[model samples]
Structure formats: C-alpha cells, structure tokens
Target: MTRQTGAGAPGSPRVAGAPARLAARFSARLEKWLEAERTQLPLWLPVGGVAGVAAWFWLPAPAAWQGFLLLAAALALPGLVFGRGGRIGRAVALFALAAAIGCGLIWWKAARADGAALPHAVVAAFTARIDRVEPLPARASVRLTLHPLMVAPDPRGGAIALPGRIRLTVPLEDAVAGLAPGATLAARARLVPPPSAAVPGAYDYAAVAWFAGIGATGKALAPVRLIAPAPAGGPSLWLADARIALTAHILSELPPGEGGVAAALATGDMGAVTQDDNNAFRNSGLAHLLSVSGLHLTAAVGATMVLALRLLALWPRLALRAPLLLIAAGCGGVVGIAYTLLTGAEVPTVRSLVAALVVLAGIALGREAMTLRLVATGALVCVLFWPESVAGPSFQLSFAAILSIVALHELPWTRRMFEKREEGHVRRLLREVAALLLTGLVVEAALAPIAIFHFHRAGLYGAAANIVAIPLTTFVIMPAEALALLFDSVGLGAAFWWVTGRALALLLAIAHHVGSLPGAVTFVPTMSRLAFASIMAGGLWLALWRTRARLFGLLPVAIGLVMTLAAHPADIFVTGDGRHLAVRAPDGQVALLRQRTGDYMRDTLSELSGREGDEAIALDDLPGARCGPDSCAATLVRGDRIWHLLATRSPYRIDRPAMEQACAAADIVASDRRLPGWCRPRWLKADAALLAGTGGLAISLVRPAVVTVAAMQGQHPWALHAAARPAGAIHGSYRRFSQADEARHHSRNRWRD
Candidate 1:
C-alpha cells in the first residue's frame, strides 16, 4: 500500500491534484451560475436595456415624469425576465430577443408619442452661474443652466415653474469667462418654441427645453448685475468647491508640467496642459491618465480595500463577514461617491460608481456579483438617480466598457494573466502593459458607435497615450499633485506645482507629438441617423451574438461603411458677399465639410465631429454672386439647374416677377426661409421630388411631413408661412406625435400617429 501510494503521488500527481481540483470546482461553481440565474438575471439585461430607452419613449409631452416612468419600467424588466428560467442559454436568448423588441418598440413609441410640436411657450426672468463661455470670432456662446428662484413666467403662462430654460448667451464673452459655476445673475427673457421653419422635423425648442430640463430660453435683454453674497451652497455646491480646492492644493507642490498633469489625473482638470503636451500623451497612449474613470476608481478601491483589510486584521473578532465586509463596502462607496462628486458628476463617473456599489452590495448580501440582478440593479439606480444621463454619452460608454471587462474577467484569459508568481517586477510590468492595451481596445471599440454618432472624432491614439501616463500618474504624479496642493495653500504650493508640472510637460509633449502625426486620428464626418443606427447595430451584433453569428454582424457595418464613404450634405449655403456659409454642424459635424475647406469654424468644432477635408470653394470664386451688409448670395449651377444661394435675410422681399420666373424654371429650391406663393410647400431636408420636366415643380421631403396644408382653401397669401406653423402646431411634436391629419381625417374618433 505504501509503495502504491508513493507511486500515485509521484506519477498520478493526485497529491497536488486535490487543491487544484478544489480551486477549479470553486471557479466552475461561480461560472455555472448560468443555471442559477436562468430564472431572471440573464433575461433582464436585454429587457432592461430596451426598457431603459422605451421608458424614454413613454415620457409625457412637456416630458412630465416621462424619464422617471420609463426608467422604472426598464429597471423592472430585468428582474421580471431573469427570474423566469434556469437555463443560461435560454436566459441570454430571451434577453437578446427582448433587446430587439425593446429597441424597436422604443423607436415606434417615440415616433408615435403625444408631444411633437409645442404650442406653449414661456417667458421668464432667470438667474444662473456662468460655467464656461466659449468664444469665436462672431459669436460667443454661454452655457448656463437656470437657477430656480429667479425665474418667473409672465401672466400669459402659468406662474414660473420647474424646467425653465437657462440663458445660454450674454453679450460679453471676456467678463463671463472669469465667472465660475457658483456665480449668479438674472435676466428677463421671452422663451418660445424653437421655430419649425429653421429646421423642419428636427428638435423643437420646447421639446429640446424639456429634455434639457430648461423651462425657458433667454438672451440678455436687460443689463446684468452680479448679486454679491450669491455663492455656491449646499452639498452640490460644497462638493464642487472641494474639488476646486483639492485641485488647487495638489498643484502647489509638483513641478510645473508634472504638477499640472498630476492635478488633472487626480481631479479631472486638464486645463493647464498645453495642446502640444496633450498630443504627446495621446501618442504615448496615456490619455486615461487625465480622466478619473473606471481605472482610477478601481485603483482607488483596491488601494482602500488593502489598507482597510490590514487595519481590520489587527482585531481578530472584526475580521469576519458582517462588520469587516460592511466597513469595506462603505469605504468603497465613499471612494466612488467622493470621486464622482469631485469629478463634476460626469456620466461615466456615476455609471462606474453605481457599478461599484452594486458589487459591494452583493458582497454585503453574501451573494455573487456575476448574477444578472446586480447589473440590473446598478442600471436602475443610475436611471433613477439621474435620468438626464440616459440620453448622454458617459452612461452608455461606461456601462459598455464595464460589461466588456466583466466578460473578459469571466473568461480564461484573465485567470491565466493572474496565475503567475514572479521574483522580480519585469513580468508584472508586461502584465500591466497587456492589461492597458486590452482595456483600451475593448473600450474604444465598444464606444466607437456612440462616439461617432455623438462626438464624430475617435481618439485613435488614446490607447498609446494611456499606457505611459496611467502608471506615471497613479504612482508618481497623483501623489505630487496632493503634496503640491497641500503646500500651495500655505504659500508653498509653487514648488510642488513646479515639480509635478515637469512630468505633465513630458507626457503632454508626447501626446502633442503623436497627435501631430499624419494619421493620429482618422477623421470621419458625422453620418445620417440611419448611418449611426446601422453602425451601432453592427457593433452590437458583433459584440453580443455568439461567435458563429458575428460575421452576420458585419452586414450593418458594411452598410455604414458604404454610407460613410458616399455621405455628403444635400445643400451648401454661403453669405451673399462671399463670406463663409455658416451652416451649423453640431460639435463635430464639419468633418466632411472641413475636408473640402481649410481650418474653418472656431475651436475645431470641439472634438465632436471627426470628419475634416479640403474640398471647400472660396465664396468669391463662385460666379454670379452678390452681397449686401446683412446677407450674401451666390448663384450656383448644378448640372443644368440654376440655383441662387441667399444668406442674411433682407427686410425687402424678392421682386415678385423675378421670384415667379425663378420659381417656374427652378428644378429644385432650398432656402432658410419660405418665399411667398411657395404655400403648401412640401418640405424635406435632403431631397426634393420636383423632378424637372415632370410637373412644373416637385419637392420631395425626405422625412415624413411635419406640417402640411390640406388644401389652400384660399387662406391669406402670407399663408405660405402659415402652413409652416410647425407640425402638431398645438402640441409638443418631439416629445409626442400630434398628427393633425389623423385627428381630423375622420371625425368623431381619437387619433394616434
């Protein structure tokens, strides 16, 4: 027996196998939660994601409680679905299909909702703190969310209410720049629905106001005064002040560049790092070092747990579950919440914080985190906490990144990476590099869809910059920032600030150098809604479906690729006197337009649009152009069609006879305004159906008609503008559908879009 046992131990390896087997069994048990979660958790993820958006669809026009209602519904779906089954595969499938249904239903419901065109308007006196004022040559835009106390609606509307729109602009750009978020001032202004005439079928002023929670809109119509003693107060205010103070303290000790960068990494203030330094950081893939995101949060948590556990170890009775785990979790929450508030409550920060809390809660409850319920719980908390974020980038991208990381963590790869024990730090260094690169790729790929749709530009070198910067920041820079800031308050911050400033300088230099390279960023223009949806769908399919189905995911990708290649705007406008045509592109819309032109617009369109090119034609070069002080126009001939371009509205109307001649011969007409006699004008953004030689003139509105005149019925000639009374003229169109035609097409019945 001894011989046999010795032989088994030496050859069969059963002696070592016992411990290995136990570890394997434990891991498998956790993974096999497929069966355990079969009932509800898995089903909820897809259901919940859909419910999230659907709830958005269900929001009331004027959006009263819509956010809360929809978010609740979405939050509830995951739990309902997850508990229905014990099959992992079945749960996943259920959720996947649920996701599809949710997406389609959301689109349909939103398309069919009650508020489309807003008939109501508000006039208010508002006071707000100036957050940031961005300046350009001609226009200076101010972003100020309203303060409740100062806003009061006129007697024409109900007394001033919640959701008043803030005054976004004031005349003076320079003075406002110095004003911080806590500053307050007041303005009396008229708030009305955004006219449908300017942009048909797009967001109306009222609907936009609702989503933004702005009750009224304002421009400085009266003199502004700074009310002294009006300062930031309350938890939100205190947190913000603390963040600023923290940043200031941190920069006091570090060397200049190093200090600045260290401060940014710690406090999310990238203001001091110059553009060149930023570029170098990017090329080196250290950009994440600048933002306090998942990595930052996780590192903080890890550090906290380690330190806390060591403290707890000193007390034997305290080492067990309840007290120890409870304290641990609370500490984690503190780190997450404090960091979130300090970072201005950015969407990503909230998302990560919620996610961290979910896992922590699971530990407190003595359960596993991999369960679908936690995911659902986290999502619901976020929506309930801040519905506005549901419509933004941070929540979406942060969750996706977290999900991807979770997926990889559930796989064999993570296990392998963590298995090795090393005598020195070389292998650890390699592991860190690998982890950073993998994380970068996953996050960038996951967010590419939303980023393209929303921001338009991709940080192609974001990964490279992160690799170098993250470590420098976590180990050396962040400490320097804290040290600098602490000393700076005592009139000693300069030395610390200088010290950290140098490190930042190095990283910034790297980022700038890399950013300057030929292909640092592959510029692409913002695409159509269809294009954005298709791209997102493609990405989703690639990410979610089984490996075998991934190839099929490329179908949408291909469509998006083709669309991106062929994409171009239908109309171009120029000022009559040969000045640049200022067609508005959101933050990054001018990418394609930029490719045709050179360095146009102020501030590179704010990194939102990635498309830029050099095919623009000079305003003067176009023939048959004339100019007036307010507007400019150039007559452009596309093929055989003669198109007269006009900009800057003139008080005088066009000559009736010439207008008649122009309308008669014109194959297609596009304008910023409706000309007289153009009544019952069928409108669309991209195309006009009025083909030459078919009927006298045809107009094809690419989208469904927002406003339509059943028959002229001999209304006033100014009725041309009358028909343009906005779609669902008496209601909020974007918030909900108000199809007048359906309402009146057949009397004695209710109507829905």
Candidate 2:
C-alpha cells in the first residue's frame, strides 16, 4: 500500500540501465547518419581544410611547428586506431587530416611570402622594374607596382634598400613616361610600410599586401623617368601585351561605356568602366557578370565545345574516326584555359577555370558531372595552391555560389526539372524559366551572409536581376563579342560588334533600372566573427548534408541572423591619425567631428556605423556640439549616461583654459598629440601614441569600451608592422586604398593606360 522499495519499484531496473540504453541508442543513430553521409564525407574534406586555414589566419600568432604537429597527429590518428573504431572514427580522422593539411599549407605559403618590410616613410629615389601598372582615371592617378633594382644613396651619404615590391601612386601624366609592365623606371617616392585595417573587423589590406610580397606603398613625388622600354621575353610579358592588345581592340570597336563593359567581359579589364556602372551592377546583383567566374567561363567553354563539334561533324570522316564528345571536351578545356588566362587569371577566374576543366574531363571520361564532388575537387585544388585565398570573398563567394547551385540540382525534385521530358515548347520554356529563377534564389540566399560580412550589404533583388542579366550576358553579349572579335580581322565584324554593343546597352539599362529600385541593397552592421562563423557552419551543413538531419542547421543559421540583427555599432569612430572622427548623437544620427571629410573616411565610417545611406552631419551643426578653431566638444547620450567627448580639430594646441576645462569636464578625449598631465579623461585617452599601436578606434558608450584594430587582429605579423616605425621616421597612415581599388587601377593600366 505504501511506497515500494528500490528493487521492487517499477522504474528501478530501467534507471539502472539508462546509461547503457542511451549509449546504444546514440551509437545506432550515429552509425545510420554516417552511412547516409558516406559519399558526402569526402566532400567535407575541403571544408575542414578551409577551416584549418581560417584557424591559422585568426590565431594570434600561429607557428609552423603547431601546424606540423597537428598534421602529424591527424595522419597518425587513423593508423593509430586502424580497425578499432567504426565509420565515425574514420570520418573524424579524415576531417582532422584535411584541416591539418590546410593549416600547414598556409604556414608554408606565408613563409615564402615573408620579406623585410619598409622601416617607415622615406623620400627615396629608386630605380625599379615595373611589374604592374594600374590606371585610375577617376582619381587622375596611376598606380605602379615595382621591383626595386637600385636605390640612390641617401642625401646624408647613408644607404637603404627596398627589400621587396613597392606600389606608388603617380600622376596620370607621370605614369605615361614609363607605364608598361616590364619597363624600367626611376622615380622619387614617399614610401611607407603597408597600413593596417582602418577599423576593427574591416578588411586588412596590409595582410593581403604582405602575402602578395608588397612591402611598401606610397605616392610618386614627380613623373617617373623611363630608364628602359618593356623588354618582351617572359610569359607574363607576353600575356600582358596580348591582354592589352585585345582590350584595346574591343575598346576601339565599341563606344565609350559599352566598350569598357565589353572589354571587362572579354578581357577582365574593368578600368574603363565608370563607377556609376559599377555601383549599378553591384546593387542589382549583376556584379557577378563583371567578375570572370563560373558563369562566364562555363558559357565560353560551352560555346567553344558546341562550335567545334558542329564544325567537326561537317567533315563526316573526322566525326566517324574520332571520339566526337571527347574532342569537344578537349576543345572546351583549351578554351577555358585560354579565357582564364586572358582574363588575368584572378582567383575567382582561376577557380572557375579549374572547375570547368574538371567538368570537361568528366565529359571526356563519361563520368557524372556537376556534382558536389566536382566542387570539392575545385576547392581542394584552390586551398592547396592558394590556401590564403580561402579567407577572401572571391574564393568564398565563387565556391558558395557553385556549391549551392550544384546542391540544389542534386536534389531529386530539382533534378526532375532538368531531366529531359516530352512536352510542348511553351511548357518546356516555362519549366526552364522556373528552374533559372529557383537557381537564382538559391544562389542569392547562399551568398547573402558572405556578401553582408565582407561588404556590409547584400543585394535584395539579385535573383530578379540575375533572371534577365545572366541570359543577356551569356547568350547575347559574350557570344556576339566573340564572333565580332573573330570576324574583325576580315573587317566583317562591324555588324556583330553593333549587336554586342546593343546587348551590352540593354544589360546596363537593366542593371540601372533594377539597382535603382527601393531596397535593392540591404545594409547590415558589422557582424562579429562568431556570428559569421555560425552562419558559415550552418550553410555548409545545410548544403553538404543529404538527410533530414540537415534541417538542424537552420537552428544555428537563425541564431546567427538574430545575432547579426541585434549587434550594435560603436558610438564613436576615430582614425589613427585623429584627423577624422565620427560620433552617433543621442538622436541616432552620426555626426562628424570635423567640417570636412575625405570620401574614403566618410564611406568607411558610414559602413562601420551601419548607416551607409545616411549623410553625416558635422559636429558644429549638431545641437549638442560646441566647436572652435582648435577642437570640438560633443555630447553623446546613451540610455541614462551622457558622454562628454573632446576631439582636436587641428594639430595646433588649443587655448590652455579651454583645453583644461574641456579635459576636466569630458568623459573621453581624443587628440593626435600628447595631452597635458593635468588633463585626464574618465574613460580613455586616445592620443597619437596610443592610436599608433591600435591603428584605429571604435568607442562604445554603453559599456564604456574601446575596440582597436590591433586587438581585433591580435599579434599577427601584418598588424605588428604598424607598431614598428623606425626612429625619426614618419608614421605610416591608416589604409588609404583598398585592394579592390588598386586592382581596378592596375586593370586600367594593364590595358592601354
């Protein structure tokens, strides 16, 4: 009648065996999941390797020995437990091995790229060979990347050597003096070490430059003297000459705007394209067309293959004697390689080239094509050869777009849409349209997080734009352009050129119309690494996994989205030199500390503050700001606390009484020069010395915290160089130009600068 004893109770035996029961159930489910993912497991090898590369990049100061040790342990793991553990164990070992290899690859690559960085800013006259030239007509400048052959002796009879490649921004007229690759030049330039990130979590151009073997960058003091003409011997020189010639021919055939776009599509030269067109393409999500990646390369290869096959079939003897499909595939492969090389062989183009070649090989061998395995192979090759590329947007976005498309089609439902079936032309057309739309949507969704992470904005209507732009470019413009080039030698390409120009005009019009639509671009605040990592992990899980378990990925993806939405930007943004400062007022509008601001500074601050579209009001214009000749005092109210900020407007010292009173009353003080001992801020003192090491500052009022680029970057080599200025030398400025900007400039010069 009363409570039962332990052994007699109904739940006692079950409780006693719960651990064993749970273990058995878990093992059964694990084994089931492993079997379903057996084929997919190899696909994750690249993911693991990329993760290792990311780990290496993110670590404070990762060492080669660490990578080596990790790799050794991973290789020995399967061997150590051979025939002991089940499928789960083997999978773990495989992933670990892949990650270790990635880490090791980056370390080795970094070691090779390492060189002595410029000590500090110096005005030295040096003779150098032009490795590359970029024409930035928009800025009226030409950027030259050079390998120093000799440096003239210092005025004081001292000597210095430019250890690695250096980039100089020269006046457009000056660049014309010696503006070709492989040409020799002599010029006096104000060279400084590569700058660090402008803001925490912003793109680190310094890291990229370091890996690219560029130790210093500067501006030319005067026009460069042509020491020697471009010597034509090397393959690089030949490619450069050919690319320039081709771009020039296309430009000459077409009108200004259309010609620039055509040249970009044909030869990967975006130099002549106006910024307005660039913006439209970006906003409309048609930006991918401008980038010579999967879509362009695939279309080129496909066109070549089809044309070759048709021409061969015309000769019945050759068709009957040869493996026509293999021949076509071989033709496609050659065209893919040639197109890639002609397009400058950028990271994305190269990645696409490798993938296209793989697909062509599959066609030749009659193997399953357009699968995740093919994508994995392409990714593996990229990570192996250019492991650092895994961290860049080009590699991430290119691979993600392809992976998503392939994965979507791999689904049984989607595969049915592509499989041949008997139907009316209208019905078939509708199905194809729907499939393209679906693919666009899938690609848009897949690329959103990465786009937002790198650019702080994602195209909201990319799918809709791509629906029209893709076919327009692939079928109409590119093919027409190719044919025009082909018949141009016989002077019969005028009509074709006209057709290509018209198609391009339509494409540009579409981009402008779609990009101008409301909410075409969705701007988000700077996302934390953790949140981005979560989204990446979730996306990979969803895309890679085949079973219902993949739905679990939605949890992390949702969480990451929420985290991103909830993230708040810092209240104040300050440049390292204290020449520019921005603050968010109590009214939620950003205010500038100075009356004037550079375009680069303004845009960077806007993006960092998550208000890309908003115009910044000057400090004196704001209600709670008081400004004078030497400094500006502003009030930023967050919740119940009011923060008093005193920012210097000029290098000259302010009035003693005014400075003392401002410092005494202020909660934060920001100046480029050292402050007096008697003047102190309650929260932080961000002066020249402190900012030098930090590179830039993002101040938060809510928690009263400061996040520096140094802290965000940790003790990486690129970051360390910012704090290593030589004695009596001028300090290097914060990031002045992004790699993308430089690349655009270089492209302009690469082809008829």
Candidate 3:
C-alpha cells in the first residue's frame, strides 16, 4: 500500500525525471558547442599564448617561488580538467596547456639572465667590444652595442666585471666614425637605466631593454678610441659587414634620397632615410614596405621559386629527373634564410622567415603551402622562441596583417567572388584590380585600429596610396631589387641596381604626393587601455572565427569606438622630472609653464589634445600669473572657482615676500627641491621625491571645489618595483592647514631674502 501511494502521485515521477532531463540537455548543448569550436583550436592556442605573455608583463617582478607556482598551475590545471571533465573541459584544457607553455617559456628566458643592471647615472671608463653599430641619420651619433670587458671610475683602477650589454650613443667624430662590430674600444661613459614610460600606458622601454640584454643606456663622456681590431669577427659581424657594404654600394650608385630607399629595401637599413621621407611613408601608409617583413619575404621567396622552375624547364634533362617544385621550394627556403640573416634577423624578419620556411616545407612535403594552421604554427614557434616579441608592435601588427589576409581569403563570399570566370580581357583586368583593392582594404582595416592605438594617427589616404604602391613594389621593384642584390654579390649588376633605384624613386614620389594631400593623416587622441584591449579582442574574434558567432565580435568594437570618442584629455599634465607642467586654458589651448624644457612631453600633450601645432603660450601671459627668476605663480579659473598653482625650481630658498604671497595665493606647489617643514603644513606640495615615484600626474577638475587626480604609473609593473611615496603625507598637511596656520604664521613668513 505504501509503494502504491508513492507511485500513484503523478507529479512525483515528473519531478524525479526533471533533473535527469535537464542534465541531458545541458550535456548535449555543451557537446554541440565544443564540436563547433573543435576546428578553431589552433586559433584559441595563440589567444591563450598571448594572454599568458600579457599576464606575465602585467604582474610585478615575481619571486622564484611565485613564478614556479604559476608555471605549475598553468601546466597542471589542463591535465586535471581534461581527465575529470567533458568536451568543454577538453577545449579549456588545450587553451590552458598553451598558456602554460607561454608562461614557462618567458619565465625561463628571464631566469637565464642573472646579471644586474649598471648603477643609474654613473660615469665610468669601460673597455668594451663593439657588437653592433647603428648609424643615426641627421645626427652626429652612432649607437653602439657594447660587450663590456672592463669598467672603472679611473683607467688606472682595477677593472670591474660588467655583465650584459650596454647601448652607448657615441659621437660620430673622427674617433668613433670608423667603428664597426668586433672592434674593441675604450671610452668614459655615463650609464643610466633605460628611460621609464614617457606617459601612462606608453611604451615600456625598461622591459624592452631588459629583454634585449641591454642593462643600461649611455652616452660616451670621452671620445671612443679603437683599442684593438675586433676579436675574430664572428658570423654576426660578417653579416653586419656585408649589410653595410651592400648599403654603401647601393647608396653610391643611386641619388641621395632614392639610394637610401633602395638600400633600405635591399639591406634593411632604413636609418639613411630622411625624417621627411619617413613622415611621407607613414602618412601614405606605405611604411610597412620600408621594413623587411611578410610581404618582402613572400615576394623574394616566390620570385626565387618561379625563376628556379623556369630555369629548370629550360634544361629538360634535369627537369625530367628532378622534382622541380620541391627543388624550387628548397631554393626559396635557402634564399629566405639568407635574406633573414641579411636583415639582422630582427623579430619581424624572423617571423616572416619562419612562416615562409613553413610554407616551403609544406611544398617540399607535397602538401598545400598556405593554410591558417601553418600561420598559427609559425606564430606559436616565434612566441616560444622569443617571448618578448609578444610585447612588441612588430609582432602584433605583422601577425594581425597576415591573419586578416588569410581570414579574408577563406571567407565564403570572397572565395565565391574569386571562383567566378571572366569572359573578356577588360573584365578580367577589372576583376584583378578589384582583387588588389580588396586585399589592400582588408589589411588596412585590420591594421588601422592598432596603428591608432599605438601611434595615435591614421592615414586618411592609405587605401588610395596602397592601390598604386603595392603592385608597383610587388611586381616591379622587389623583383628587380632581388635580382640586383644577387647580381651585385658577384660584382656585375650595375644595370639592375639602376633599374631598382628608378623604381624606388617612383615609389618615394608616390608616397610624397599622397602624403601631401589634404587631410592625409588624422590624429586620434590616446584611448584607455581597456578600450584598446576590447578593440584588439574584437579584431581577433572577427579574424579567427569562421562561423556566424563572429558577428558578436562587433559589439566590443562598437563599444571601443564609443569609449575612444568620449575620452577627454587631462586638464593639467606634469612630467616625472617635476620641471614641466601643461595646463589647458578655458579656450582649450595647452599652455606651458616652462617654454623650452620638455619639448617632447609638451608636443605629446598637444597631440593628445587634438592640437595641430606645437604652439604653447608662456605662463607669464596668463591672467593672475607672476613670474620670478626661479619660480612662477598662476591662478587657474575652472568654472566659478579660482585654483592657484606655484612652480619653483628652488624649493630650499625662501624669499619672505614671495613665499608669503605664494602661500596666500596658491592651492598647489610643485618643485624639484624638498619642501620646508614650516610651509609643508599649509600648502600642497609635489616635490622631487613625490614625482620620482608617481612618474607623472593628470589632474581633473571635477567641479569648482572637488578635484580628482590620476598618476601615470598607477598599478603598472614598473610602479610595483618603484619606491612607494606617501600621498597621505601630502594630504595630511592640508588637513592641519587652518589649525596650524596662526601658530606658525610669523616664523614661516621669515624667508632668507
């Protein structure tokens, strides 16, 4: 009777079965999603790898134990998840494993280098072997990579063992002009740590310097003298020699500007290109052509393969017996390797070479050479071998350009468009032109956001510029240049070099003409890090996914655009040295406190404010401002309230009348010197000690009475290692300002003057 009563309840059976049914439905959905995503595992791997590298950079310098724990967790979580869980877990496991590999790789790279950096701002004499020399155009300096043999304060003292490399900017006078790699040199130099980020979210020169094994940067205090002939110039030195020799030959053969472009194309030496030419290339969106990257690698390799095949066909005896395609691909691989070495084996060149090698390998294996899988494999290899590349613009932009091109070609609509047959010569020609334009548009669209994010500028005429530039470079210039280089190697290619120079002159002319057009470049203000991240994520999603889900990626893109548009420049900006200050006037023009000092910082601030020129008014010209020999006092009117600011070079000197007047007038005082104890309680001071830790500051006038501030170094990795400055100490003084005013008024007013 009891069993019957329980079973007879109709709702009981349904409720008991509900949990089982729901579980089945959830499992089925997860399986379906995983099946859909299975083909995208390669795409996800790079994403995870990038995330791992970014996480490492974002974190403070981790201790040995912490780094080890991260490596362990990154490795172990995937195995545990895959072993115990379902399809969804397996996908996550794959991503986790890739991330783990990335984390471990970077950790290992960092761990292997145990040498400490040179003490900052120390002047000493060092005997160093030149590893590399880069000549600066339009400057009387040569940048030398030095391997220190000995360092001392005085040449007579015992040598100090210095580890790692030093980047020395030596004056290119008689003593150093002939300097080349492998030469030993002695010089007195002042070494300092690499410069910190110029502004918030700016480039991290310190991290880049650290990863490059360059512990410090310096300028020679004395003329560098050759101590000895370079000790057995190694393979790298030979390569450098060859590049320099090739560049010199090219320059000798062609016109000044034209020769620079030709040499840059041939030997990866863009240093000779003038600043005006650089601006033209940048504005015309043809700057990538100046660098040896995927385009150069592909063109060179493809030309080598085609020429090899053609030559083989001419000799039927060899063509019949040999696998011409495979042989050609092998030849192409060799050429790619040679070119990579010639170009200094830079990260971008290496990446391009790897990808080209992968394709050549595929051809050698009798498989299709071009595929997303191969591209992903090349990127993963680059990341594993050089983890620091993940933080670089070249790696990001190169990969982005390649991935976007591949993704666009794989699109169903684009494939269908290409599959259609043209009926006539004119129609086919039109189709070819359309294809070229489409390719340029796709690459430009992918790179535009990134360029804006980093450089804060976009080429308005980039598409039009590329339409003419790409075909000319790809078909005419690069092919001729390659042949010229090969012929010049054996000393018989003057005609080819002449042709290449002509083509380069034409290319430069195009760049100049395009760049000079109205509104050729648009300057965008800097955006938030989060907004940039979202934009990048959206771009990756759109390029990586093959399904309709890619449409969802547009959401983040829109949000990023909105965020960027709404962003505002800071009202007041200060440099880390506490020597430069910029305040936005009511009319929105940026006014400088010191007109001469901090030109770069001021120009950057002006660009961020959407100003076209680097024009700044003097502090003396502003209303309610007074300037003395060493200090300046100004009152800023925001809305209905007046906020006073005092900037002084000598905080130690207390001129009675000036000090009293400043105290009565100013709300904030910034100086390079430490503030006096008597005045500290009354005025808000940003002294040298504070500026050192903060890097820089941006103040926002929230309202007439309320103000908010943000620091450039806020929560960044560099700040984590920097000495902590107490903002509370400065704020505390303000709290007791009124209470302590009467007690110290008379004594505090007694200035030295």
- Among all candidates shown, the one with the greatest TM-score: 2
Which digits, one per residue and each the tens of the lDDT, describe model 2 over residues 633-723? 7766676555577888787756777566667666678887867777765556677766777767888776556777776666556665347
- Can you give the lDDT of residue 663 in candidate 3? 57
lDDT of 3 by residue, 148-260 (tens): 98776555575444547989997767355457888988998888776665445445576677677777788888888888876555788788988888877777878878877
For candidate 2, the per-residue lDDT at 227 reads: 86
lDDT of 2 at 497: 95
Off by over 4 Å in 2: 1-17, 63-85, 586-588, 721-753
For candidate 1, the TM-score is 0.63
Score residue 94 of candidate 3 by CA lDDT. 67
TM-score on alpha carbons, each prediction: 0.63, 0.91, 0.86
Ranking by TM-score: 2, 3, 1
Higher-lDDT candidate of 1 and 2 = 2
**lDDT score, candidate 1, position 454:** 48
Query: Candidate 1's residue-wise lDDT over 1-753, tens digit each?
Result: 445556355655787687899987875674465444334444256434544453343332324334444444464466456645434334544454454444444444434433322234555566655443222112333334545455565567666553433434555542332345556665565554333212211122333344443444446655556654336477766665676666555545455456456656676666555454554554444554666777677766656766687898788776754477678777877877877777776666667777777788887788875444565567666655554455555566666666665554544567677556764798787887787788767766766666655445466766666667567666555556557656756777667666577766666666677676776765454355577667666765554433444567789988986897675432332211122233322222321111233343322332322343232333344445444433344444333333333432334666565444444333223333434554221112111221100101111112222222211111211112233342233122112212542233234221111
Better candidate number, 1 or 3, judged by lDDT: 3
